[model samples]
Target: MRLAYVHILPLEYYPPATNAIRIFASMDDVDAAVWTSANRKSLPEFNCDGVRIHRLPFVNPGTSAFLRFYQCLKWHWDCAIALRKFKPDAILYIEPHSAIAAWIYYRLLGGKARLFIHHHEYYAPHDYDRPGMKLVKLGQKAEQSELFPRAEWISQTNESRSGFLAKDNPEIAAEKFQIWPNYPPLSWNRKSTQPAINGPVRLLYLGSASFHDTYIRELVEWVARFPDKATLTISGFNVDPAVWEWLEKENFPNVQTFPQGWQYDELPERLHNYDVGLILYRGNTLNFVYNAPNKLFEYWAAGLEVWYPQEMKQITHLQEATTQAPLRRLDFNELPTEGPFPRPAALREFRSDYSCENAIAPLLRAFDL
Candidate 1:
């Protein structure tokens, strides 16, 4: 049996478990080829476990949102052509973008392969529960209607998505929507818990593109007051030079900014050393809400307690101890001052389910491998 995997989302080798379903599937003898988009800036290919990969061409010259969308569309076409050349018996697609496009292409082209999709995000609007967020939800639901039923079957990471669709759209079989959470690569390992930084905690701001620069500004405001006690680190690729220079120029006593420019497979090692893993995302867009962030598990794999407002869907496995919301304005005025942050015991155990043992089963069963 041969499978053709296609996606344009980011890819990396370390954390071993990052995008692990694709990595592990590629490792199996039945695994055929993986066709995915390469970095927008450079194309470097390493043997990702055992899968043969084809990187889509780098086509972005501007950072406009429309241009980025065009690049993703262009890369999918590139990936589709690549898949046709490989001629696998089946196609396994990743969520958000993969399912809808593949369905349109497969129907139009009439390929011999069957198609399947897996979704890890439980996408909701940033203001989902508010009256103002109505139009936002409408847009998302419309997008879902266009895409969700197109799949022969789908695997959702959280219960809400699977359950909502089964009720809202009965045309799709209930069984087609199963709970499919991310599995860390079987190679992922637990790291020693990183003790919080002394004096003040070191906050890590992780992002993929320039979209998250706003969060860094908020961090600057918070850190400006506690420069003696706190420090912030921003790591990601494709950031503007002006943003970098602005942060440096401030020369705050407690802030240092570094561009963690695209290091795959090396993430686990790099993350293990950080004091706290920061997951600061602000968006009402489809990509942000439906996200069962890979880094959530990656941070756990490295055993760092995360600092976010609340847990995300599909990955609230803060089985051990977790901090409370609003680190920006921590209001512990009435509480006792002398206790530990009150997290659960060891994080190593909570991370186990995210490892391949739990994550890979659904993928295997999906293909009957």
Candidate 2:
């Protein structure tokens, strides 16, 4: 069966698009291709893990909603043209904007391919109050504008997201939304030997540096307070200027900085060098409260125990699901002064249960290929 995977973001920049391509490539009975936009300034064609990726022109999001909606319409036209040529049996649309574009292609333009949508986030109606959220809500509204009852839905978390959609739109059946958690491929197993826990435990904080409630600087300050207990390494794209300035001015003895972010494929091998992974989101919104972030699984795949906020519902749920025990829960206001810190012991079982292959099994089953 031929499957067309569609997403609005640049394929190289979006982890979810790459993850979907990798998952689809692993299937023996399916032939998968990706359709996405290249960077606005550049349109370069490259093969990713044996899948042929087609790139179209995309306008970057602007401050004005009119411009953003116009861009979305242009993207819909591009996707419709691509659909006519590729002629896949089914289309898997990633994120709300891409799914909305696919909906337009099928419903308005009389396309024949069955539509499926993957919801990577759950945004409440009131989530538009924050920065960058207004545009996100606009895209989400596009999906909700029509029920699309026949369209299959997938979520990156279990009940947190699926439950919200079902509650919001009672017309949609519960079975329409499948719980496909954000899991990495099975090959990212930990090494036989890890960084020793005898000395100061090596820790990492990776991903986006900009968030309203990130405690990165606070973590650095705490590490400085007890330099002999733990050390931290920080890196990610678009590291907030404030974070960089603070890191430079403070120059904590136990904190190391990497200005450049690591590529997605480079994380598995690189993560084993650290003893712990830190997730310091302050749980500012319901979306954050329900997040099943990629970093959580990436850290586990690399054999690093998590140092997460106990307040996060996603973390709490994952703790119960994976090991039935709490990880090193942080209070945010305080740091431990002890010698040895906690690490996870159940990665093998976690890997077996939530590998990307296993996570996407329900998606494949839905297609009946």
Candidate 3:
């Protein structure tokens, strides 16, 4: 079966979870391709284990989405062009704008192929959708203005987002919207060798260090409380010099800074040695509240505890890993200071289910290829 997929954040196969459904959906005997805007080495085209990926590439260089609205519009246009060229048997539209691209493909193909939308982040019931329902409705019109109906099947990652999509559009078929859990990768069996508990335990914060989510000062202040007792390691993106200066001023004496990246596969392997991981997002907006950050799963992959706020669902979902330890106010007791219940079986289950096999089963069934 010839299948095409599209997403907003480009192709990221290395971090495992970034390409979870991609790996599962295109697993065995399914000839598939991908189309995305985020440019990462010929991804959507990588040959891994036994999968063949072909990404329809479109680059928007020197372009800035000074505004969020225009950014989505530019993304939809690029995806539409990419779909028109690849013409696969079906399209799994993973992002809002990409769904519009797939819809245009269906219209041009005379509905010969199907279109499916994957929803990883959706607005909860009590709250307005991400950016609010007002913005969601606004986005709907913007995409419909380009493609006729936009999406055929909306596969929600969880129930919260699904309800919002079907709440007003009950006329939409029920089968088109199904539940697909976001199970992290199956590397859980490989637990990090526990570091010396008696010595200072190593705690880490990985991924983007931008000021948007975590202000450097807040983390420094939190670490200030643990100068001699705990050590915090920093990685992801080059550490800004200003952040380094601030770290010195905060007097986090034991703090260590390392190059902020690893060969995508190297992280889980490296994580095995750390005691616990830290997630410090300041906002409680839809971006933070509805997020199932891949890092949480990666933390699980390493069998390390995660220090996070109560607002984080993934932290709450995984009983073994996530801790309610507040970073700024801080409490080390909330962290998993001891023990390793190696969960390889959990990872095997997660890999099998989240492996492109289980994740994309619905899309494959929908197309009947």
Candidate 4:
């Protein structure tokens, strides 16, 4: 089976899209290709373990609804032409924009490829009520009303979000939807041995750090208060300018920031040194409240214990289900003052359980491959 993966974002920058394509390509019966865009930061061509990647030209539709609408139409046209040429048996479309493009190809362009939609982040109707989102809102509405019913399979990050999606689109059958939690590949597991805690616990908050609706300030301040007990490292892309400015001026002795964050492929090697991986989402939106981010599994794969907000009920449910790794819930109101937050000792035995290889089983079963 030839499968084409469609995503508007640069494939190399999005771990989930890359992971999914890799998984599909690794299958004996499937030949996978990625149709994506080249952002300013991304190379026109990328190596996804030898899978074919075709990138459309990038257009910076900066904050203009007209420009964004034009770009979207152009992308749709380009994607449809590519799909027609590729003649894929099936297509996996990530995010609403990609799904809308796939819908256009399948419906209007006489493309016969089976459609699958993956929602990396849940978005409500009102979520797209901003200035440059009129086109996006229309596309999302079309996806809910038309695409959902036609899709052979649809996936969300977790069961909670899947339930919410089903509720929103009652016309689509429940069985059509599946949960594909953001999990790292089993190959990425590099479980480090737990050493005896001698000094301060190494706490790392890796990934997108934002000033709004996150615990960045609180975490930094708390770590600053007790430099002897803990050290904080903030690293990742899309870090808010406010965060950078504050960190630059404050210059907390125990806190470090790596503005040039490590790439997704380097995570297994890069993350093992930390004792704890902090998830700092403050649950300001419904999407955030039930987020099953890839970083959680990435941290576990690297043998680090995870600390997350109590407000993320989906993560809390995952924590309850697993004894493979330790997942601690943080109470922002009362920060813990303690020493020796150690890495899990059972990582050697249980780290394999938190892999994309295992997570994608249900997806494979659904495909009946």
Candidate 5:
């Protein structure tokens, strides 16, 4: 079987995405290709395990939101041309931009391949909920055009999100939607639950710092208050300069910032250096409440106890999954003060059901692989 996989989002960082690596690995026995893009500032080509990658051409001279959108549209057209040339039997695309782009291409320019989509975020009817606004109306129309009953296969990051989508759009069959949580890769499956030393408890906060999760700012504030008790290390790309500037100016002895993040392969080892993994989001929006985060499992895989918001609907499964990796709710008043920390054996057991291999099993079966 010939297969085509397309992802319009930037894949500039490492460890390579779980889906990307899985697709490429599977390519060895079948005729397959992957189409993706990178920031213009980075190298234009990538090769993984003998699988060929086609990087879409997208040149954005400025960082403005409008320019980025325009560039992505151009990338979409470039992908469409490549899709026609490759003409595989089936195509799998990632959330938001890639899926929309592929659907547009298929609708405007004919294609016979069956199309599948994965939703990392539960994109509910935000604009449609408030239809009077001009931009909201446009947003609603665009979303409807791309994601409806037509998708051959649908996967979501968590059960709550999938259930929400199925309930919202009853026309789509319940069987069509599969729960594909943000499971970690095999490399992160290391389990070593040595207690976080009695000194300062090391904490990690990775990914975007500016977005929701006002609790992160609160964490920083808490660290500022008790500089000797715990140290927070912030890493990842696109962090707000102001946030970093404030941290630097304060020069809090306990807080450390590494704006340049470690490579993806380095995550497992890197995570072991810290005592706690933090994935906190303000559950103001339904998406936030229902979303499944990648960092949640990444921390557990590396055997670090997790601190997440109690309000998130997905917390139930995470709490139920492990005993060795103590799941702590984000507490403003204090950090984990007492431990002989739980050994990582239970978290390692939780890893069994939540790896890329298990997450993509249904997809492989549906594709008849």
Candidate 6:
């Protein structure tokens, strides 16, 4: 099987896309290729871990709504042209926009390719009510009316999000919807034998940071309140400018920031040092309320305890199901005020139950690979 994975963003920046491409390419019966775009001046075509990668020319839609709309159309055209040339047996659309492009390729251009869709975020119709999102809203409408019914498989990160998607599109068959959580590859799993902490607990937040509608500010303040008992590290590629400005002005002694975050490959070694991993989404939207991000499994793979918001129904269900990692729920209103923070004993050993290899088993069975 020749499989093409289409995503509108840089593949290296999105671990989920990279993970899927790698897994598909590694299969004995499948030949995988990635069709993606980057804003850089030059990105040569390359092969990564058995998968061929093709980088399409991309225009950075800097803050301008017109440019953003133009860029979206350009990407759809590029993707359709590339898919027509590749003529893959199956195409995995990384998001709705990519699926829209695939729909154009097969429906309008008379291409023959089985369509599969994987959504990283759940967007309700109301989510695109902004003026700049007219194109996106139309694309989503097409996805529901055309792509969803036509797709052989459609997946979300968790059951809760999948339920939301199904609820929104009742015309689609139930068996077409599947769950593919964001789990790290088994190679990234680490066995940590660190003894119980005799010093301040090392807490880490290792993803995008945004103050608006997120608990980032509250988390930082809470960590700062117990500087003598805990130390916090904020690191990611998408850390907001305001976060850095506030950090510089406040100058919290125990807090550390890594604006230039570590590469995805370095996570196993780098994350093993942290005692706890934080998920700080405030659940402001239904999409967020059912959040089950890759960080949760990555934390478990690295032998770190997972801490997430109480309102994240997906994470709460996962915590209840898994005994391999210590998962805790945080209530921002009732935070501990004193020291001697409770830490689990030696970190649990790496468990196969939490690996990407395990998570993708159902997907493989569904694909009949």
C-alpha lDDT score of every prediction, in listed order: 0.56, 0.71, 0.54, 0.79, 0.67, 0.80
Q: In model 2, which runs have C-alpha deviations exceeding 4 angstroms?
A: 39-46, 60-69, 128-138, 324-326, 337-353
Q: What is the lDDT for 254 in model 2?
A: 86
Residue-level lDDT of model 2, residues 90-155, one tens digit each, is 888877657656766676777787777777777676764567555456556666665247576555
Query: What number of clashing residue pairs does each candidate have, in the order they appear?
Result: 10, 0, 8, 0, 2, 0
Task: Please list the residue runs of candidate 1 whose C-alpha ends up more than 4 Å from where it truly belongs after superposition.
Answer: 9-18, 25-28, 43-46, 56-85, 99-101, 120-152, 163-168, 193-199, 208-214, 238-245, 283-292, 310-352
- Return the candidate ranking by TM-score, descending: 6, 4, 2, 5, 1, 3
Model 4 scores what on Cα lDDT?
0.79
Extract clashing residue pairs from model 6.
Answer: none
How many residue pairs clash in model 3?
8
> By lDDT, is 4 or 5 better?
4
Please report, as a residue range, the 10-residue window in candidate 4 with the lowest summed lDDT. 339-348
RMSD of each: 6.2, 3.2, 6.4, 2.3, 4.0, 2.4
Write candidate 5's Cα lDDT for 1-369 as tens digits: 667777765655423254555555665456777788765434233456655578777646556766766676678777877888888888877665565457656777787787777767676666345432333234235445654556678888777888887787676778888876667776567665554366777789887666355476777877666666678899876577777888888888878888765556668778878777887677767888876588777787777777777777677565776544457775544544542233343443334335776776787788877
Tens digits of per-residue lDDT for model 1, 1-369: 687776545454222224554545555468667665555445344445567777666446567666765665667666666667677777877655454346445644556576676655554434346653343354345335644555556766656566754665677767778776654554556655555345665566665434342345654556567655556677766566766777778777666666646465666777766555666554344345344556666666666666543323323333223443122212222222332243333443344336656666676677776
TM-score of 1: 0.71
lDDT of 5 at 153: 85
Return model 4's CA RMSD, one decimal.
2.3
Candidates 3 and 6 compared: the better one by TM-score is 6
What's the lDDT of the predicted structure labeled candidate 1? 0.56
Select the stronger candidate by lDDT from 2 and 4: 4
Scored against the true structure, residue 312 in model 3 reaches a CA lDDT of: 57
The per-residue C-alpha lDDT of model 6 at residue 162 equals: 92
Off by over 4 Å in 3: 13-18, 21-26, 38-85, 108-111, 123-139, 142-152, 168-171, 210-212, 238-245, 248-251, 258-260, 317-369
